[model samples]
Target: MNIRNEWVSFKIGDIYFPDPQQVAFERHKDDLLDGKVADLSDHGLLKEVFAVVEVEGIEQPVIVPVDRLSGPAPEMSAGEE
Candidate 1:
């Protein structure tokens, strides 16, 4: 889902997951502007979540919920961080 012109995505998985935040950002092949996650307790299932991936130009982020997301996101650049 998209919100405030940006996009957000959420993920849920094993109890020993690395950083969920990092994996969420990796899912996107394109650059993200700015975004974050939101709570969705209405479902009563905590396994679900929301994400906010910032979209360029639109000045907003998109949101999506998924299960079993990958591990730490791949390095964005080769240069020193």
Candidate 2:
């Protein structure tokens, strides 16, 4: 088995969060643009997710992806090049 890291497990090396086809194709958004809210299921079971979250008061299933800006730590700021 491939010993992949925890962070990489949810991602298939793509920047996007693997959203539905409509958002992926219709929107023509970039992979790094992040993913939108979605209801995911597998084997007729609802899985629990900690990272992705739904919109507040939406009363609907949502699975939005988080966007992490690329930047070095404050201490390493000088090293950025």
TM-score per prediction, in order, is: 0.28, 0.17
Off by over 4 Å in 2: 1-50, 68-81
Per-residue CA lDDT of model 2 for 1-81, tens digit only, reads 776764543333354655555544655555333223334334213334323334445465444322332333354456545
Query: What range of 10 consecutive residues in model 1 has the weakest lDDT sum?
Result: 32-41
> Per-residue lDDT of 1-80 in model 1, one digit per residue for the tens?
44787775544443247666566567655653333233333452555754443434555455555343332234522352
Which candidate tops TM-score? Answer: 1
RMSD of each: 18.6, 17.9
Error of 1 at 13 (Å): 38
**Any runs in candidate 1 off by more than 4 Å, and if so which?**
1-45, 55-58, 66-71, 77-81
